[model samples]
Target: MGGSKKLIVCGGLFLTLILSIGATAPKGIRLGKASYRKVTISWQAPDAMTQVAHYKIYRDGTELGSTASLNYTDETVQPGTKYTYKILAVIVGGGNSEFSSELPVRTLKSASFENNQLVEKVVDSFHDTPKSDLNAVSLISAIKAGFEALLGSNISFSVIDENIVTSVVVEELNWINTVTPELTETERLAVQSEIDAMMDSSFAGNSFDHMYINQKLTQLGDEHWGAGNRTAAELFYEFSLNYLSNHESTVSCSLARLAYFAKSHLTQDSSCADISESLSKAKACSERFFDFFPNSAPTSTYAKSALSQPAAWYFSYFPKMLEYSNYDALFFSTAYETAKRLVAFDPADKNAVQRLKRVAAWELVTLQLRFVDEKGNARTGSVKICNVSAENGKRDLFHGDAYVDEREFTLSNGTATVPVYAGHDYSISLNVDVANGNKLKFELPLFKYEKNKLVSYDYLTNSFTETPSSQSRTDFVISSTAYPYNLRADRGIDVFDLSWDWVAPPSFTTAGFKVFRGNMEVATVNKQTVRLPLNNSANEYRYKVVAVDANGNLSSTSQILTVYPGDQSQYSDFFEWMNRYFGDSDIYAGDDPDNDGVDNYHEFLNGTDPTKVPGPTPYAGPRGFYELTLEWDAVSNVEGATYQISRNGTVVGTSSTTKFTDVNLVPGVSYIYKVKQLTPAAAATDWGLPNTFTTQKAHNYEHADKVQ
Candidate 1:
């Protein structure tokens, strides 16, 4: 028995030695490419080993280090130096494996110099030379070019280098520091003469070059003006005037200031006539400046001030159109209108407004009347009308009869009766003497017996055709008593109809108008006049107008105007009707009816009803106390849908229901659920339809409930 036990122990020891040797032996090894900076050495241990102890790393013939991992890296090496590495697997049994295959490594060098040269060449190609070198020019030389380039390039450069270049130039000039010492009379006069010469030369021709030079001169004038060197400043300012005389610009304020200064400096005994003339010219130039540069702040403000000067100055310049036979009334009218424009341009100017009112009052009446001789011949005279009375009993006094020559005059032939207040008598008296040919001449009594009645007389034939009565006249005639009676005659509404006139009849002078339908007034416009509003609603309309005078005198209503409005519904009906006439493609069709994801027709073949909702809920789960997750196949017929989950017919949660989950319910509570699919049409329409699903009751383990 002892000998058998000894043999078994010896065999077991031999088998243990063989297994330990087999476990430590290396099975397979790998060597990566040497080009990479770091190399990885890996080896697999024999299958006979249960666990690996560590891996030994060998660099060339030396052992670098050892780790428990199966792979190792050899990091210590010089650039361009090749080194060989291998890994050895060590087992827990106190035996080691042989080295694996070798890995050769060498470090990478820096990039080539040719790439650096290419980058330098690209940068050099993009760099630009200095502008001065490219153009071969100085600043002043560049400015002499045309305004297009002057304002575009030169001003751009100045704006960019504004702080640096302007400061340098100003420092060199020392302009502010040179204003201390008093100059002798002779020296002052010399400087003033030079300034005047420069200004005169700059304004010799009308050009943009002259304009730029004038601007520079104005700056110099401002400097001299600030230093109290009035004479020099005056010279520069006079140059500005010359520039403006033919070439208007946004810089006329300088000229106006010079004129004002010159006017202010004159003694009281100085010729008012000459001062008036100069002021007139200055005002005109300022006005032109405002018109040319309406958006300029300085010019507009200066123009407003310039226009406020006394009216005598402007009146002195009024053209003597009536005095000279060669001049027409139209010419004087245009001049008056120009002055009115100035008044309108600056409505805040009190002086301008008052002057305009005075001038317009005289001009409006003078233009309205025509003077004639006793034989019914047109005569030229300034015979003005004064103390004219209207039907409302208001009287206005006017400056009259400034005739250039003496002439016997009477009212024009066929003059109609002048309208006046009913039941009132007017006394007409001439201010001329017949005895001395200048004494108070003739007096007559004129009466208006009733309202809306005509008192007609012919002065040329000395005949009384019709006297005022209760009756009204259907045939209209020009009344000598009214201003602009003949003015509206030429402005009939149409060639075929001589009824309505563009210029309002003197009967409707002051108040706005009202349009009435039969006896009812439809619209009342409270302005001086009314323009008919256009209608395009496929309807016809007729309109009539009546005027209310300033004194509350109502005129007879005007004739009617007939017009038709335009149409749109036919275009709107075209789209709807097209589908019936031309079929499906003629009109667009939207998604199918049925809330199912698939179209109605498609669901028919898929064994699913499109109108029916998807599969049952709680179909395969317990009644309660069970975590649940739900998912459904994406529906095609619906854009989006909402889902609800319920327990025992009570809703627990709701979702847009693409997915849902339920958790933590009572052990014996039965639950049921339903899902509905909703489909929506195009954004312009309402939702299409909905489909629904119902689930059976489910219970927890304690209750045996059927799951649907």
Candidate 2:
């Protein structure tokens, strides 16, 4: 009975194993022929022997349907939406296969090809309005229409689209006519006269093409504008506008042309009336453009470009006009009002912010200056700060120069409060008139603030010896130095462990140490050590340390220590490589971060960065004489890295470079191959997506009838 029980248990284990066997999942599922609204997915059958009734496709975990064909077109996909897909083979008899690897696909976004004609229609509806009705809305519509129609589908300016060749030629003609010094005013006028006569002849029996006439007149107007002939440019622009104003397609171009003509009147003139009239015209056109285009629209960039010129003019002349402010404040006041209007329209404009910053004198930052006596007691003195970044008499015509003059401050209890410009550099000195008008002027190091923050600061030194205040304070006043020293960095696989030495000054306790990478502060640590992650691509790093006392007093910064990394540690472990590249050690073995179809563990074994899309996959092609050649891109970053080539799930050969030839293959046999990058430390690499090629068949020589 005991023997019988042992045999039965062994039989039961064999039956369990046999029952677990099922169909295999589909192989080589990949995208093909994708579009904005549709995507086609194709895959190979699990095997030739397995009777697959159909292949089941799942999108985002929902079963779409089953298809007998090898490819499926997903027409229900939405534009710009990302979807996950997986495939499984349904066996003919009973059990189904496991799901294939998930493929994440994103559909393309729609191009900017719609609703453009609607903008044109809006311009045409208001084209016939009276001069009194030429408000911001009507003018802006014309500008938008003009810019888009002139550029014609090349709004991004990446490439000059062939469709806008006519417009480009017209612009080139205008450029040539203006900059050519050989062309006389009489000669230009004669040509304009002939064009005008031809334009007028169009109403009669014989006429020039209205489009040709319009383009020529506009070109002449642009030439005149460039030549500083404002009156001529305005006359030509008006003539050009009259010809095209009635046409739906050219109305916006006409209006924009006229607006540019008006703006051409702005010149460096002493007369305030001339300046105001030209500025008002430019401001109206620019404001109209801004009001019409929303920030999120693609055309909004053109609007910003339009407004930048006027805003720049405001900045250039505002200060210059201040010189005349003493005679009449109206000049400066008008410029100020224009600035307010521009800011009110688009507060996010960067040019407007710069103009305001320049007009407001400077960014104000309140700084505290501290001092101590030779006895280590609070020393009271007077402080003087010199504006080293400013010129003596840089006056603005409109707004007076608001330079920060050198001033003296009284130090109370070892500290004095003073106001300084944020971005301006300054040199400071402290005077303690103690003995017979004997003044000890401590020459302070120059420093600066930006955006109301103290970016850098250094301690003061006496005139006798230019020693740092930290060391000088120890010799003259304070008893000890608190700055850190002896900073050492130890390189790890993915991190650098930084250790330093710090000794607190007398009566001062350690608060924290600020770690700086170059001039930027990276971290604040209470301990003497910090572990910073290493960047794999960077070969070296510079570090400095500064100590903060418990009383919030900062010491002098330590000497900069540059650390050069030794050997790369990512090659030591797969997880280290993943963490170094992706900043994620928790990534699963099968995760594809860059969506190049190869998973992480395979990527690690192959010596490729999981965060970056890898280069070309392996290629297998059948050569004549029953042989196959396998080729792949060589892995460059990993030193001494080779490739392992496998055929039909078995290791066939190893290559130090990128190519390997396989011989002694069976004729007419199809083989699937996989290639993996192998570093010196890599023991084995797992299989990934496969590439297949069939060997050339040998000619059969045996006779069928057996008569010979």
Candidate 3:
């Protein structure tokens, strides 16, 4: 009588087939077939309604079957059995009409259920030795149709696919989950049509297999963001046209030959000989274009007439690898001119259309190749890139080399804005002038079509990093840069103090040096100092620097610097030395390589060994506006010693002198404080008495001075 807008839930899974809508009665209830072991119930939807979502069938009084279209067949009936059927029309606006008058039906005494018995037989015979070739899918569909015709909806059945049963339910779940969200209404309709075709008995056997492959091909296109209803034939047509777009008769003819060969694998192999021979002869004509399309020849020749009918040969084609690499102009005024003449004579010529699309997609297939420094700022350069071989499922094209480096393009402002076809593979490399002879450098592999159109080659590493998911994310330094000056381990920032600094010789001419971590150039530091972020505290890293001149020449590297917890101060002499190279080091100074509470500078100034911590108290100076400073009391005059001060157990500042100013405090809140001194040996002095202080409280809300 009534229905609510509910999620289509059937049995245990979600069903989307029926859109049960408003109440409106269907007319002309009738029994189409009544026989033993089978019964068919039918009804007529009113002609007034423009859309009928489905018909919900009810048996006796229980709702059971739901069919998207008219008619239903019930095969579960026993011989000589009688049954009653009623139908409710489900409409698009989430409404269900009243049930139609019941149709009384009976099973005949002699009706045999051959499909049902065949399913049972297949299930019983399935095994691993020969993986059951029996058509269980069709048999299941027939059985489902029979049951759904009467009482079952959301009908799905599976048998042992092999010795190991394939879980069809899981496959269905994945299918629904992967596609439902992205499926447009049109796409859904197309998918449904494919599904309907699959269950259609007319498309049985190999024809059905071909349909399934084409459906998946459409899905592949969808996955890659291709739009519209595209058929396999259309894809092949576009592919072939891309070849003929060269406007060369031999090029077109060569591709035509390939297509003819390819079609044999797609359809009946024996029937494709004429097409294959014709393409061969066409290639021969292209080679002899001067003789065949002579300037003296009449325009109304038999050859010209046949050339107008291009559709017959223009479905798909590919030039041989040698032809692709030749790079010479072809099929122009000679053979290609003849093809165009045919096209002008016949616009609907399938050959002409296919050829033009190939030309069109040529523009579509190519994407920009960008080159930039690790920072991704565009730079100019003559970069060479090799493309991985794309056999297009036919490796015979690339005989000797599996991959070729034929693709080479220069950068305009660090980007080659040229388009390349899909499935092209890229390998980046460039020669550098070094102490030795020029070495062939390489970059990471960038697969075309698999990656976005704008691919990047980093300047520092000469490699490709990750394919950035967004344009903004590519701004970060994923690669490294070279830096100059002897890198000395220095104090890090903040309390956790996981950061480490690389201090180099300061110079006004220092444009910036590249800072490298392993093979990666992490950053180009304009200043003489750089700090590692605390996030990398867990990972070990090798540090080296090469200063860059104003002219951008990198000087000789100073030496490799190593850091591990508990070894920050072991290399202070090497770090402190100018124009010096330090090879071996267990630690460095003025840094918290040990990750303990205090820094090396504080330990040095507090008359404590830079290697030990909790040694001396730090003295505090007068606090200033918006700044709090703490200094290590001059208990020891260790060279390059510094002080660390904290407010209520939180580190606030570091100073080289015995006195330090503390700034930026709340006006009213009282805070307890502590201080520590550090030295060149990466030592720290801790355990200073907690001194409590209260700042002047603010009374006026409007004054900006009170906020700081």
Per-residue lDDT for 57 in model 2?
A: 95
- Identify the leading candidate in terms of TM-score: 2
**TM-score of every model versus the real structure:** 0.23, 0.25, 0.22
Error of 3 at 573 (Å): 35
C-alpha RMSD values across all candidates? 44.3, 40.1, 26.8
**Prediction 2 global C-alpha lDDT:** 0.55
Better model by TM-score: candidate 2 vs candidate 3: 2
TM-score of 3: 0.22
Best by lDDT: 2
Candidate 3 per-residue lDDT over residues 51-71, each given as its tens digit = 788889888777777998677
User: Which scores better on TM-score, 1 or 2?
Assistant: 2
Backbone atom clashes (below 3 Å) for every candidate = 13, 12, 67
Predicted structure 1: lDDT: 0.40
Task: Give me the runs in candidate 2 sitting further than 4 Å from their true place.
Answer: 1-213, 220-232, 235-281, 290-296, 299-301, 315-435, 443-708
- Identify the runs in model 3 with alpha carbons over 4 angstroms from their true place: 1-380, 390-403, 406-420, 431-442, 447-452, 455-708
The deviation in Å at residue 4 for candidate 3 is 74
**What digit string (tens of lDDT, one per residue) describes model 1 on residues 1-708?**
332222112111111111111011123554322211344445666566456688788888898999887656555544235576777777678778766666544332111221322222221221222211212132222222322221233223211122332333343234323432344333433653665476466543333323443455466556656656665555555444433444332355664666565555444344545544555455554455555455544335555554444243344333232232233344345445655766777667676676665444333211122323334344332222222233324222112332222222243432222322222234443332121122222233442223444433333223444445455421112222211111011211111111232234535565665665445666666543333323323343555666666887666555444443234244334334333433443111122344535643344334343335454333333223455545444444355555555544456675565565667644434445443334332211212222222333354575454431
